[model samples]
Target: MLLFISYVILLLVDGTKTDETNTETDLALDKPASSSSHIIHPPQAVNDGNTGTTWGSNSCFAVQLADYDPWWQMDLQVKVKVTKVKVTARSECCPERLHDFSIDVYQEQPSNSAPKVCYFYSGSVSNPGETVTVTCSRPVTGRFVRISGKNKLNPEDVLQMCDVQVFGVAISTHFDSCASLVQYKQQHSTKTPLKTISEGIDNTAACAAACERSESCTGFSIRHLPATVCELLQGEISPSLQADVTWDSYVYQGCFSVCE
Candidate 1:
């Protein structure tokens, strides 16, 4: 399995799609969860390798997001202002038991009596080659998040969660003056094309402006790059702010209105 060490939605343009193939930029997303490398307050449960409740499938999945819940979870941590959340089911992780799943957003940790649920997606894992993903409610907060499930494996020892992911860029950025933001990755590289060897911009506004002017850019990363260089990123829009909205209310709802 790919050691998605970072786990954050680093992003992949995926090209494009149609009826025969569905290729649209993944969609909007909320904040990302904290990776093991930077766990502030570790979850109540984790395994031997600090992967307690959140164990890396140790494999690559090819399923979609809508396929597995109560079986696998996707945690994220980022530095952007997010508005939506998307999860995909790959062929590798959370197989078989992923028919329908649920997501719960929590302002604070869900008590052991009822672990706070964030966003859940379910009902369809048959995307085959597509990225089985779904959205969440009004968007929640926090720089760190944990996605957990209850039914990822059956007695047969089948595993799900081969390839899981989250997408969404910061809505805006506030550069710290002539800083250059650099994009780093754990699973892959950034999607936005860089230019001039990744130079520094005057301020956050200038950074956003640089992104807006780029013909291929769908969005920009305000201060994602390293501090040594005030980088202005161009590509997908991302989120950096935080929220506490929950997806429990619409565990069984989805449609155009959900965009609200």
Candidate 2:
């Protein structure tokens, strides 16, 4: 009887450790990536699951010379609560180029606006092909993650990375049903509504369903000012759209059929 009890306790402890280990998922694998500029390799090469240090076609992502404060960014498509970020330095060339950089997280698509800094590396990488991991000081939530060069050694300091990884848990939202059907944006538009539904809407999910059912609807805006107000929009949704603290917007991302 005592042996059986000991076995059960061991299993319980092992299961708990497994659950904690699986909490963080890699959120930046093969996601849409972009950068300031590249010479031979593009930004997508860094997150292609290849850790090769060779500065070739499928190995490294390199920025052009004279590109001061160059940056590489990844779009996770959905909002994530970022925990940590990992970057691998190139081994064949100057590993010191990866020095003095900051990892930033943004709730919206990054532009000229400032972003929340998750971690900053103030020193140069000591070893080639070394993987450096930076843990956020606090819980940071955003859809976009960026790594930018800071305090460059020279004006022409170029940023080269072999691999980049982001680890986090996705934050669930009220519009999760339409998440696979549309692209969620944190901003709203000012254009006149193609149609408006101020009644029967309880939350953003219901508002998204209403827009999905309309063939002419290109996007939507939902706000809860004591009551839910949904506005179906027409035409393209641009980043220049207006931002409100109370409003959440989404753009139709095209599907096989309207969301059921």
Candidate 3:
């Protein structure tokens, strides 16, 4: 009986190890929740799970605006660690139109904030029949992904994409409401009245929450009492700005997990 029980336990352990190894490959393809700034074919065609090349006949195709800086954007809806972006090229025509393109991933829209560049292809794709996979140097976390580049052959900037497939795992970023921004200091520890500080902020929780969700905010300052208020700063607290001790300030640690 003891020998049989031991053998069963060994089998279970091996089974668990096999499951763990397959988790990443089994991850579902993250389809775009929504798409914008596309022309001709709807952006949904890219991730519609169809990779056929019958453009105009088959609805799964995407084309962007011909104007300069034209781009295609997709909302992943939730933060994900994007491992790779696979783009299926159009075989019907104009394959060279997609030359010099970039794939950008962002927590916020690229227009509002700087995006992390995942992969860039400067020349024309080597193969029009095969899927072109752009693997990020490291997995990036973001809710939105944008593919933008110039159409070197055309007079205007344009891009042609099909079957836009994204592969990755979901992740969450941490923001402590009770914790004060660590890098900030009180602007006036001795003289500035809390009422004179700003208005609307009441506690560290509210102040921290506001800055935590903002991609542009790097640190913040708050005051207490009659008119509790908070002021958000764009970047890290600079030495010149840190000299002011009138308001309470804290800096974000800016921690996030990346792909190995």
By lDDT, the best candidate is 2
User: Using Cα atoms with residue i matched to residue i, what is each candidate's TM-score against the true structure?
Assistant: 0.35, 0.59, 0.53
- Model 2 Cα lDDT, one tens digit per residue, 194-217: 898999998877887676555346
Could you tell me how far off, in angstroms, the CA of residue 41 lies in candidate 3 after the best superposition?
Answer: 1.4
Q: Per model, how many backbone clashes are there? A: 80, 0, 14
Q: Please list the Cα RMSD from the true structure of every candidate, rounded to 1 decimal place.
A: 15.8, 15.5, 15.3
Instruction: Tell me the spans in candidate 2 whose CA falls farther than 4 Å from its real position.
Output: 1-24, 174-260
Worst 10 residues of 1 by lDDT: 247-256
CA lDDT of each prediction against the hidden true structure: 0.33, 0.73, 0.57
TM accuracy, model 3:
0.53
lDDT for each residue of candidate 1 in 27-92, tens digit (9 for 90 to 100): 222212222221123222221122111124332322233433323323332222233444434443
Model 2 TM-score (2 dp):
0.59
- Ranking, lDDT, top scorer first: 2, 3, 1
- Model 3 Cα lDDT, one tens digit per residue, 135-195: 9978777878888764546555356666677777644222322223354444522222222
